[model samples]
Target: MNTDRFKENFLSFMNGCEFIYSEFKNGDFGDLQRVEVESFNKMGAVEFWSSGWVGIDLVDCVSGTQEISVLLSPEQRDLVDGELRRFADLMARR
Candidate 1:
């Protein structure tokens, strides 16, 4: 991955998306923190939870299917995934 490009895109996405944060207790993991961000156009969302995990999905508002991988390149996905994990780790410190 191109670190510079990834960082640039990740920052741009985070700045643009609608961000929400919440924390809850899990039986196995104690406290879990979650951060969710939806694309400006509402076509994609990324969910990041504590403990080194992340999820990315492209939404189809009409069909309600999540098979819209064409909206993002593999490199873009990887960049988002890595940044989310990093964000989760940062949240853990708070």
Candidate 2:
């Protein structure tokens, strides 16, 4: 997994974004990380896919987001859900 590309894309997506919180994990597949970015009232989860090609998905809190699949390596659906849940939880606490 080329993590350099992933980081590049992540930073691009986070343009003008105010990072609220983030999490990292050393999983069985690879090193997975979740970041919550906010711009004004817009909030979404950015999951750094470590097992596949440098890829990430944007999911709106009120809008249903599409999931991206690159290969049959592994799915980080739980991580995505967890990021959203945790982001909301953290935002609520603030």
Candidate 3:
């Protein structure tokens, strides 16, 4: 949950994946933000967005957006969930 550890883990997760670059309105801040992610396994041209706390798969390449409620594999989900929980705990302590 420390910044250093989070960066290390995030980099490890993202390494070797081909990330497509894009950005959009986040609705909170009046500014656009960049999104980088490995291409969608099924769609081939979509990227995922972070839901503030954790990254959730989202497709915004086409006309309508694709809401990925559950996209990651079981093992990947487990890893992400664990990391998110750790991050929350860390924030609470601060």
Q: Which candidate gets the maximum lDDT versus the true structure?
A: 2
Query: Per-residue lDDT for 1-94 in model 1, tens only?
Result: 2223334545453555555656666633234444454543344534333333344555545556553333224435556555444543332221
lDDT per residue (tens digit) for residues 1-94 in model 3: 2233444555454434454445565644232233344433322222233443334444434444553434333346445556444423322221
| Top TM-score prediction, candidate number | 1
Angstrom error at residue 51, model 3: 10
* Comparison by TM-score, 2 against 3, better one: 2
Measured with C-alpha atoms, the lDDT of residue 43 in candidate 1 is 49
TM-score of 2: 0.39
List the candidate 1 regions with Cα displacement exceeding 4 Å: 1-11, 27-30, 43-51, 56-58, 67-94
**Lowest-scoring 10 consecutive residues by lDDT in candidate 3?**
39-48
lDDT of 2 at 4: 42
In order, what is each prediction's RMSD in angstroms? Answer: 10.4, 9.4, 11.8
Per-candidate clash tally: 0, 0, 0
Local error of candidate 2 at residue 40 (angstroms):
2.9
lDDT tens per residue, model 2, 1-94? 2334434434453446666445456765466655555653445554555664223444444444433322223454434434433444433332
